[model samples]
Target: MPQATALYTAKTKRCEARKKKRRMTEPTQTESPDTTPLILDVDGTLLRTDMLYESLWAAAGRNIAATLKTCVTQWRAPNLLKHALCEIAAPNVALLPLRPAVLDLADAARQAGRAVHLASGSDQALVEAVAQRLDLPGPHFGSDATRNLTEQSKAQMLVERFGEGGFDYVGNSNADLPVWSKARRIIAVSPGGTLRHRLEAMGKPLEVVEDRSDPFALLREMRPHQWIKNLLLFLPLLVAHEFGLSVFLAALMAAAAFSIGASAIYILNDLLDLESDRLHPEKRNRPIASGALQIRNAMIASAGLVVLALTSAWLVGPPVAALTLLYMLTSLTYSFWLKKRRWIDLASLAFMFLLRVLTGAVAAQIAVPGVVMAFVFVVFFTLACVKRMTALARDVDHGKLPGRGYGADDFRALKVLAAAGIVLSAAAFLLYAFSGHSGGLYGSQMIFAATVLPLTLWLFRVVRLSELGREDYDPIQFVTHDRIGLMIMVIGVALVILSL
Candidate 1:
């Protein structure tokens, strides 16, 4: 009983000491009377991104269930969650995006001889690392294992240390309103519309940092352009030569379901790939990595999309709903695990493409032949190879180190696979046309010959572009915009409709 009591007493004393240390974090001296003591908010003020969310997703990327468990257990103590995630995910501070204007503001304050300090709700160690990396002067304040120094806590701390109105604060959200109420000068960065209104309600003079992001950043986050790949959901209709309005509507419904499901996967993939995406030349500018959209919003969007996907698939029928669930499960697995595995990632992507065709058949009640399915799979598999090969070859040319399985020399073997895929697809297309099955449905069997011409032209063109190191762009997106690729699509679609 005495030993147990002694252990409890020791733990109580340590906790008290930690709290005392945090309470006394204020600098003993504000340096000079002339110092206005400029304070910077870390997340949305100085950085284009938020570290807490970045860390959360980074940790989640490794082991989502374990991360979720830790977060849930620490929910009652928000500060503990902050501390745990800091240790588990500790963001790549160097790669984190910073606002140029915010940096300039800090620089000006320092040059004017103001005492600059960083204070954030992010973990103490993480915030200090950021301050060090930015070469900022600070008696920095941050959340600890016991206290999340944010909003009210942060305002109270600064008020006690510097007295009301003694310091200037730079902040960006509604959470910063409390701190701003006590600050001498209010500097806001990229505040949302409602936050802007609330900032005005304070009746304090506002200094705004103009946002230069695209207006469609949210839409870009959804990646509607990538939905073009989901048009594969119409392949079964096209191959079966079903042009009835009802069948087309069913295919359209199925397409919508698959596309929405794919978007959810895209958002999830972007979250998991956040760190690596920040290192990539083109991908670094993605909405998530570039901080154009918040991770919380992205998660909510993913959930909503999944719900919509299932609803739409159910409207199509039971078969399509089941297929949609399968696609989502396969894609989630690919995003969490298979994406980093070499050839498996390619195979998974190809299978996803094939699933679209299968769902289209089920949705439209078409009896597409096995040969046609093989053709569709090979076509998409070749496109997947093109996508992977172009990216690796581009990375190698740019002198960036490769990750997620393939190396610099791996693009060559992918090129071979892409060529083999194209050859096999062509063979399948020819076999289907000559089987005398297509002739009974279409006005002319010669339509397949004409359709193959444009497809062959597009496939060979994409391959040559990959060889020339000019295919750095997303192969799917490129098809939507490229002049020749667009022409090929137009010709192919027109030929099919004309034959019908």
Candidate 2:
């Protein structure tokens, strides 16, 4: 019996050894080397598309303002603009903008032989487009392949793709912390607040890339040169022969007040559009959109600004106050409502420009000349058309305008509007030169005409450039800093002042 048992045991040991050898000889599916991957978020981390929102807002402002005069509820404004822009310029529209730094980092990682993956909550298509642009190879782990990658969904994706030994993550927000914690190495991008401090306490390795500053961003949002219409508000004072220093000072005050109020409106607009802006390519990093400034904080700042605006208006008296209210109403309507309407939207925008001139006149206690009023309307309409035409051109160049709702058809419309603007603009300049007022404003009739020729040519050139998508500028910055335009403008202004 003992001999039989020993024999069986020996045979079992031999069989086990043979099986082990066979397993070792054959290739198995199990991996030996572990992989550490880098996961990045889409909205705040990889790319920003806030500019798309601003552009859409601008388009909406042109289209929506013609309807109701009283404030439109917030709910209506959001959907109205979203639907309108999507319908008008869908080709250039996209979910979000891509960040160059994020791509740079991904490239750096690839060069360093680090595995790269995107763990985002954005739509797979949008993120993939961004990844492709960045040359990222991914079995992506994030939200629905089609929707946005966000919050808890992003963390789960990391686990689903790599399980335990699959990745080390890099990200910029608390939303990423869940996956970051699971990561072998956590490379934090633009870390801050509780998450930053918590990660530090946990002794995680963190890397920070500061956001870039864009000075022209705000001016782009507000379309500042449009403020030139504010100068019209002073026309009444000029006609009243109240062009004295006091009236001039009052007019200046109103302009300043309107600007401040307008800026405050911009902040609010950014806040309301924050989510949509996050998906924009250029606008995502806006001071308001990038999470650098909290919405609560932004609201507080806006309130403070409004208080200052009201104080300035009050100091200027009832006429100034009333005009300020009108300005605020117009701007707010643009920000919230009229921006969603179509041609009516454009009409309202033109009216707002005309009103700015009227306000200046009222604040200064004067009656604006009929020619000046006509000129303001014509010039403003032409410029508005130019602005729309530029946007349409951008949509064409980009192939599509997403989220904002514009399409190729809209681009065609913008082209037509721009052409109309050119014709009307030429007409306005001619009218300005030939009108009887040329003698009073320019000194010599011929002097005004000469200035008009240059001014008209300059305007045409700018419109053409804008239509060609050459001037991808915030209107204010373009008008104020474009040396060529500024120099020509100076000559035109000098001619006008000399004539006066």
Using lDDT as the measure, which candidate wins?
Answer: 1
Where model 2 places Cα greater than 4 Å from the true spot, the runs are 1-34, 49-95, 104-116, 121-166, 193-197, 205-229, 243-246, 264-322, 328-346, 385-500
Q: Write the per-residue lDDT of candidate 1 for residues 1-500, one digit (tens) a residue.
A: 99999999999999999989987995565555467888999987788778888889888877788789889898888788888877677778888888889899999988888889999999898899999998876789999976898999999999998999999999988899999999988899878889888888888878888866666776898889888887888888767667899999999999999989989988988988888889888889999888877778888999999999999999989889999999999999998888778889888988988898899989999888998889988887888878776776677454434337777677778889989988888888878876778878777777765777777778978887876767756776676668877888899888877765
| C-alpha TM-score for every candidate | 0.86, 0.58
Candidate 1 matches the true fold with a TM-score of 0.86
Quote model 2's TM-score.
0.58
For each candidate, the alpha-carbon lDDT, in order, equals 0.85, 0.63
Cα RMSD to native, each candidate? 17.1, 11.6
Q: What is the lDDT of candidate 2?
A: 0.63
How many clashes does each candidate structure show, in the order listed?
A: 0, 69
User: Which stretches of model 1 miss by more than 4 angstroms?
Assistant: 1-33, 190-206, 212-214, 396-403, 442-454, 485-500
